[model samples]
Target chain A: MLAEGRIWKFGDDIDTDLIIPARFLNVSEASALARNCFADLRPDFAASVRSGDILVAGNNFGCGSSREHAPLAIKAAGIAVIIARSFARIFYRNAFNIGLPLIESAEASEGLAEGEKSRVDLSAGTILRISDGARFTAKPVPDFMAGIIRAGGLVPYTIERIKAGS
Target chain B: MPMTITEKILAAHSEKEVLSPGDLVQVKVDMALANDITAPIAIKVFGEIGRESVFHRDKVALVADHFVPNKDIASAEQVRIARDFARRHKITHYYEGGDVGIEHVLLPEKGLVLPGQVVIGADSHTCTYGGLGAFSTGVGSTDLGVIMATGEIWLKAPPTIRVNYEGRLNPFVGGKDLILHLIGMIGVEGALYSALEFGGAVIEAMPMYQRLTMANMAIEAGGKNGIVEPDEITKAFVKERGPEAEAGAVYYRSDPDAVYERVITVNVSDFGPQVAFPHSPANIRDISESGTVLLDQVFIGSCTNGSLEDLRDAASVLKGHRAARDIRLIVIPGSPRIYMEAIREGIIETFMEAGAVIGPPCCGPCLGGHMGILASGERALATTNRNFIGRMGHPESEVYLGNPFVAAASAVLGRIGAPGEL
Candidate 1:
């Protein structure tokens, strides 16, 4: 099924320190993490977030460090998808491994205003911006990756496969 | 088709022993690591993975850094969990702050890292070991957790990019300067998922410590690992490290006619000190471009640049002069070994005499958890990697990245100055 959410804008190179600082790593409880997501970058990020919001960012989003806390913290904080111009290699895998859907669109970041509604068709590989009627093509998540995400993260997905004796 | 160093190594390490770009290779990992910040989660995931024994008990390293001395009660508990896991697993190398400094520095000092090894750690700066010619990369806790269980990871053998550096470096221009210069040339996305190889006369001339500085920051350019083929310098470093380390001293070279996705040639003599401004490591500026940073604080530490050589360089700038009255200068040695060496060489005393507060060899303040963090709206220059906004303490504080000389010089001037200016 296609998923959609309102857009939250962030600039390029939004690092792990901003997404989920090291100070918070000690607490692995996802709910507590949900409160401090983007504590450094945008102080109000936690309170401002909706249950199914999408983030559109500039190039090199999720750069700096391999802290999975960044993605987990975001996913726990109610972010459904993140559409960036590009993604850091390790962060990309971390997000997908944990079932936090991320899309990369060439112009999803450009012409994007905060709070603008975004309609994403995961299968079609298109992100439709409702306000400006802008349609941007996204780098399609591969079928294998899609299956993993649908299974809700690698751990549970792995468990399901093992349970099915596959 | 010619093979790049990264491709060649992955090919040698893979099960099929023949790899192309994007092939998921599940090879036996030489080592797996995680520090204080990452270990707690890694332990949790390791438990959840339902594997009591790791693939290789002797292939794991756990270090307690990032918030040593237990910044808070919670941080102490993370260190506790890490210690318990290390003991229970009978890890090959388990280090806590007493003798351990940063994981990057401590691993090499303890002779745990070797050349040509493929090392993965939960911490991103795990790339620091690339200086040893190892294909070291960073992964998330879940990935590390899986490795902790199965001792293998699925990875695409990346393409290689060789940097043939030529010419002699200017005395003032150190390895940190060279890496910064490369990042400035390549920008952030230049080497995504690629192995970076260092070759040429310049690399051959570089000391092990200096070469480590260059390889450690390959991540800044988005590369998987920045590696230098082990040579005489590498041989000496490993030889002194003992026999166990000798096993890991392998080097990979591209086939003479090997084709590369990208080849960046750098003339070492042409570069100078580089500073990353604003919020990005890739937002680098040459020291020759702008001479001053109006900095109020100067931090000198991180696994990447916090070392004996790094502190020695900072001491050179702070030898006779005291830090400026308005500026706060803090120096953190990378490891306990480096810390002891600096103390013995009087480098630590020189920093103290010059008004630089010497902190224990840990990742403090560099990550801005504790130590010399910045206040809101204040500007500081640091010798560590990454200056993303709010990385060091106050969210409103500004961070500028440069070599140790620039940081020391900034401490003396109460503002950043080009090399030797202080």
Candidate 2:
């Protein structure tokens, strides 16, 4: 349950429309969405993003439009984790429902620098900066929700439940 | 525990005796909705779940809005997918063409949603049904897919934040200005994960359409839903179109001693029309301070302010005048029903006579989906909710959020002006 990655920092209120614009909504495939992640705000994001990179953003991340494409694109683009000061409620649930782990830590999102390597311990709900060895605590995901994430999102979780019942 | 209105409704839907904030409960959904933008993906997920059929076909609604008239081939294919799924599933409320409009407005207008029911939609403005006393919230496409299969979904009982707006309303200011000012008073995330309970004498006397306008943008301030207590007005409004809703209405109000996470109050008698500037709905100022902001386009429609009353108000302002020579004014009715009513009442004729373009009943430019996408450096004053950057068009374009009166006046003056200026 540990995720390690280089940080990609963003500012406050980075809305879902910016993460994946509505124009690309026609294509629902995860790869197509990943190809255009952050196409507007950062044109080079989809190209330059490396696997296992983390997104660190200021408050109210994923604020506008309830498009789950935003989180789907991030996870599809190989972002290992998202650490934001706070998130819009719908985005928070959608991210978790899709198995993209997110952490909320005001101190970490504010202090983290772009390109800094960080380690996120999902079980412990702690984030550690690799360079300076700085530590920040994130709110722990509820046990039931943690189980859902461990099962690789709600779909797989439901599939397992249905299979068990049968 | 003393329960707020939202808790009571959720408890009823979940068949629980009592509920509290942070409690997770699976509630039976009375209605589920999706638009062209989200329905395609939801249908995909529904197929992926390997379900033979939906749980309840009549309870699910699919509306082709967002990119109506099919802006491009991709968008056309998206709507075609939703249409095919709805046809295959025989969903009772499949809507397209003239029947299609913003789902939030059309649901209530068609009586598909009722008070005391639990509703969920794929679009954020699903909270608009709270105006009629339903406990509704938005979810993602996957959640909609799950609801289609299971007929229920788990939700957290949100804490209530009481926002009491007292005092008389100003002459020209209406629900749009009130909501804009409130969002400005409280930052974008002020009510994160909380239900906003709107009350006071002003809300009590406000028309149901105005209440819908106010509750529609509750999500703009990060509220799970915004609701008003069901009263005689609500009963009457629902009774006219939906006798079942009126007969089955569960009238629940907050206990006087109910606990609230926070309570914010504002007196609107002295408040004038307010506008949210470019980039954010929270960046607001009074119309008087707008300082001659020029406009390239003026739009009056959306789930927020596209009702018959909104059209009437705009027509009243533009009765004897024409839009500015360089300005393009567009007026879209909320639904085909509203469109027909406006035509009968001559509201549409008035707008067209004033040189305004009348479009179909669709959410054209609101989400920057199509119809009126702004060009670079262009500015638009619209009555729709959300002024987020690139919301109406290009990232460089600016959108100012205001009411129909301000939109009409600005159209006439070619600036971000108010009704008083007219």
Candidate 3:
């Protein structure tokens, strides 16, 4: 799948609490969580984020907490893909489990400017900076993760497995 | 290749002879856990999967500790979902009301997790069980749901980082300080996707509670898990819990020739009480180097340090002195068992005499769910795990983390001071 969007840049150690504060965690609805995405760190995120916008962040994105709410909030907030220099282990798994694509590209994370248009070819594992015509390669998603993404996340993938008697 | 304890545990559960870092394997979980914050989501996904019953009713644990006693209608609803699901599934380890405690502490206290077992929880602090030699880590709610249905989850075998702490610990320095110091040394992502196997004289001499404290904060360092090999201490602790606990327990240690991704050694002779500054646990400084930062509140509880020993330490410091006139000291014993033990030992009276409020056994203000939340400009010193931005309340509010001794002493001084200062 190809994703085209404007970039929203963030720095390192962007934690789960900042993505979706604990105050709003009582509610698990996707839209309810989306409304409070980045409620504390970026007060304008929920309202200003456009659909299909890409997020670029520094190291250890989603560092604290194992709340899937953090990833669900970002995905519901119209973030099509997250390109980070790195990601915390659990958040990396949670995002893909929910079918939210993430790319690891230090070059793209550093080279892309905020609000600049970009295109990400998910299967091709390449990122294109539309404005500057700069291209960067992302580490290919692992084989197992690629399969999960193709099946539209873990729930459906798991459902298929259970049905197939595996 | 010879294997570390983590790889050995994974290999045993996955039915593999050997495993390597970055190898994806599907392993059966000995115990699967979810709390109020994550259980509702897991329940929803389980409903979508249309599973009639959980994979193993005895293996699944649902605890309503976070925002428990129902912080609000919303939190009440979340707990209700977990309660209903637990009842529907006849989950053997459903805890609530008088029985509930922080999931990480509650699990070990009940002997639900054992050595050489692969345990997974929806909460990040699930690694706490690794202190008992279990290979435990956190996963998302959906992952828990899948595990509930299939009794298995996919995991990448993490490379192991062996951290050896030699030398005698300084006065008042404990597991909380040591873990904080380690995180400060190796930034948050230092151990990312790796298992931290703690060893050396200090770790061997450390008590079970202290070891659990260190393992509890492993996630703060971006670790997949933090483990200490099972020894006489682990065996004694498990045996005391009951016969059932010792039944399936298998103590596994890393082979002498096991490979490690990195080996880090620290001499603890000079290490003192360490405090993680606001906004990040990695922003650490020795208490001696920490400036006079006043506090609005001091919380001396959580899965990290809310054990019986932690309460004893805090009560010892607060025996005679009362909290500063304007400061709020909230003491939450980790579980009902610990609370009752404190009551039996007169520790509750010490805290009450210190002008502190004793909260029920729940997460309390750690996650900013309820209890003593901070205002915009307020600051707090806590014995809990993370001090991320806005963790305890308002976004502008700040939190500092230290040991229970520091927390109690800071309450008396109304600032971030230590027991020696008191």
Summarize candidate 3's per-residue lDDT along A49-136 as a digit string, tens digits: 9999999999999998999999999999999999999999999999999999998999988998899999999999999999878999
lDDT of 2 by residue, A1-166 (tens): 9888899999999988789977778777889999999888999999988889999999999987889899999999999989999999889888888999988888888888999999999889999999989999988888878988998887777677667863
lDDT of 1 by residue, B1-422 (tens): 66766666666666765567777777667889998887888888878767668778788888888788788888898899989888887886888858678888888877787877788999887878888777788988888887887767768778778888888787578778888888888887788888778888888888888788888888888888888877788889999998877776776666788776778889877767778887777788877676556778889888878878888888887888898898888888988788888989999899899788888878888778888778899988888888877888788888888888888877888876875665
Computed on alpha carbons, the lDDT of every model, listed in order, comes to: 0.81, 0.89, 0.94
The prediction achieving the highest lDDT against the true structure is: 3
lDDT of 2 by residue, B1-422 (tens): 79999999999888688999989988899999999888887887778778899989999999998888888888889899999999999999999997787798898988888788889999999999889988989999888888887788889999999989899888789888888999999989988899988888899998999889988989999999989888988888888876666676677888888889999998998678999998898999999888989899999999999998999988999998999998999999999989999999988888998898888889988888877889999999999988877788788899999999999999999999888887
Better of 1 and 3 by TM-score: 3
> Which lDDT tens digits does candidate 3 get at residues B29-63?
99999999999999999988988999999999998
Supply the global lDDT for candidate 3. Answer: 0.94
- Give i-RMS (Å) per prediction: 1.6, 1.2, 0.6
Docking quality band of candidate 1, CAPRI definitions:
medium
> Which candidate leads the pack in TM-score?
3
| Segments of candidate 1 deviating more than 4 angstroms | A129-135, A157-166
Estimate how well candidate 3 is docked, as a DockQ score.
Answer: 0.92
Query: Residue A95 lDDT in model 1?
Result: 92
- Share of true Cα-Cα contacts across chains kept by each model: 0.60, 0.47, 0.93
TM-score versus the correct structure, for each prediction: 0.95, 0.98, 0.99
Off by over 4 Å in 3: none
CA lDDT, candidate 2, residue B339: 94
RMSD for all candidates, in order, please.
2.2, 1.3, 0.8
